[model samples]
Target: MAAFRDPLAGFVPDALVLVALDNALSRGWPDAAVSDLTRDILHASGIADGTVPAPAFAALLGDGRADLVARVRFLRMALGDLALGFDALTGDLPTFMDRAQTFGLFRYDKAMSDTAAARAEVRPWVDYVSALTRLEAAHLVPRLPGNAGPDWLEIGGNSGAFAAAICAARADVRITVSDLPAVCGLGQEMQKGQDRIRFQPRDARKSGWAAELGARDLLLFKSVLHDWPDHHARAFLTEAVACLEPGGRIVICERGPFAAGLADASFLSRLANAVFAPFYRDPSVYEGWLRAAGFAPTRQTVQLDMPFHVIEAVRA
Candidate 1:
């Protein structure tokens, strides 16, 4: 297994890749068959000479010139790299599996039901990812204008991890995390004793969800908007703008366009795009939506290596 020393592990394969890999396997490909095909492709491509580039590799996988078994093997290796990369960063495969199973992105349901069992299964994964996102938030929150005020509202905030991180950084910052009722309950439970952080049940699509909150100085939508397609995303932004206080800010942090770094795109990156094309969008699309919502882009940071973008916009 390759070892990654960076705290964030540079890049882990997107969860979407794992979903595609699992789907292919479930459809009947065997491990031994994939392994044999992988060996054949390596010999045919003359990978030993190291002359084959990423596009060539992508062609081999997608041009239909290669056999189905070979293509499946190629995908498997990419998914394996993601697994190894995540393990290298966190050193906890069992925990990752628990989260992966609960997330169920490959399944038709795509998440557990609202039963107690569902909450129990999903909470740990939410907590784990939230903790990781909190590190990023720590770097980002301080960069916002000091005039933004102490009131913070996080849309789709899960388990209150980001809110907790913000409150920890500045004790007076009050945080309200809006999410589904089950998720809100889990966050409320996790944030007990931290009176500054609160979770409210909300569905972002429902009209007036943001209106219920009155006005907030800073609204956060971390890894949230990308889950929806354009029309819904635009509507959410409009609602978010209405929720903001005059001169308030809305911060969006999400996975940016997959093709931006295609010159050196890893197998995982390509597979992520294949699986999540509908959910991913270029940052310019976000800029347009912000302007449409009557907000002006104030700051934008694209972390090309880590492959995420943070766009901060303020009400005009």
Candidate 2:
């Protein structure tokens, strides 16, 4: 009974309704079962505006609506982090929810759509250039000795998606993508037939096996640093620097400031902070950290399709 009633204590009815309406559970049920349940509860609660219920929910749950209760229970538990408002709950939902959505579920369709939307939305020239700054470290691939291939490490690689993509594109580079155990499991699964990509678990924060990430031509921080506070980020950079080969590079893709007077970027900034945590950085601060970590800054740019500043630096 406690297990069943647990989800009701902090129910956000509107978010449930929104989840129901936008059920793109490209994954299987009960994961995709939010919509039907939300519809029933919203219709019965008669909130009209689609806000979550307080009293109405109690009544609905008390009436032995087990299936409805179960469905709502699942969605409420899944989306508990959303803190959704009535308008957001009722508005047409985005098709995908990524790490930014604050929701536990990672709807594939929504993630792809959100990525596409993010790319289309980034517009300012300086902002785009800033994104490419972090990419510069990874871009060193082209500058490699041309014949002597370099093995690389992709720290905090979520599902090895980008790593696999990179491996597929570059035969000369062997990328070992590392993350937490569970994420590495997912990445391992995703990288199944790819010989150039290997998945491993290496926590970049505390002292662990991460120190073994040794002497590679490039250290890929793809889109990870901003998720941590300054101290942790600094430690990560120091560790990465130590692991690079002479003339080795560090490439980072992180949320950074946009050019002056860009309205769209303001929204993106807020969204990234809310999603990525610890807040994104000013370019100067990031560059400072890079320099202090014994890296020589090379390039910084914001890619047209991304909100991140791509930064490249060489280990000095």
Candidate 3:
């Protein structure tokens, strides 16, 4: 197996990155520690190779700014803490999911209960990430069955950002986002003026959700499926396959277990994985599900820097 690479390996802190880092740091760690750690990381990453000057570092890591101590701590944990039984912190998927539910972190069902406030609180960060990868996703469109004029259906597409990206790239494609009624309403509001994209209320766990959309040429599952256990994930694939037309394709993009070995992953990435470990599986698990759903794999792309995997399969 190839060694895992860090998603933020060569990342230079931009404004957004700094803000996010700051937010994470503010949760813990002192200002002095953060400043010292920021300087150390900057020097080590070669971003402050003596020529950058001390005032620049001061500006970036000033007292009121977000601290980098958490990042330093993550690096230490990734390297040395594993030897001290830190790996025990990561439990299997079921345990993690149970703990998350107990803490009210896994509340998709609640958000879907026709509550606008709950839906509003659920930020569509997954779709934002998808939008960032829009070009890469768009490149796969031509490989699908009806690329010239595909009828697309996205299951659990919150806020319709991914669908909007597809529609923006391919004018001939008509994309529909299927989610719960509350989520669909939020999506419709988010995509108010996009004619190529539409929103429909449907539960993904149930079969025949796609009956109203007729046969779709391409089915998309972005950052979904891993939320459920093996049985539910398989059922989702089965239902998705049933919704597809002859020669139609299914595309699943999600983060999986490939990041466990990423020694240099960002602190935020490590924290997220730790929190959601139970919801992720290996790529092979998804391949098995697709096979069981009666689809043959056409392409698979594993991101080198992150744990994200894009698996595309075709029906018959």
Rank by lDDT, descending?
A: 1, 3, 2
Residue-wise lDDT of candidate 1 within 83-160, one digit each (tens)?
Answer: 554553246544554454222422313122455765665554465455446446655556555667889899888888
Q: Write the per-residue lDDT of candidate 3 for residues 1-316, one digit (tens) a residue.
A: 3444333333444333343334334544333234555545555554443424245444444542312333423333333323333344353433433434222433566556657675654434323333334423554434344452378898888778778767766778889888777777777776899998888877777677557767788888877787777788888887787778888888888776745536755544554345445567877778877887777765455543345667788754
Q: Per-prediction TM-score, please?
A: 0.63, 0.55, 0.66
Ranking by TM-score: 3, 1, 2
lDDT of 1 at 242: 81
Give the Cα error of residue 7 in candidate 3, in Å: 11
- Measured by lDDT, the strongest candidate is 1
> Which wins on lDDT, candidate 1 or candidate 3?
1
lDDT of 2 at 268: 23
Model 3, CA-based lDDT = 0.59
The regions of model 3 sitting more than 4 angstroms off are 1-103, 124-149, 302-305
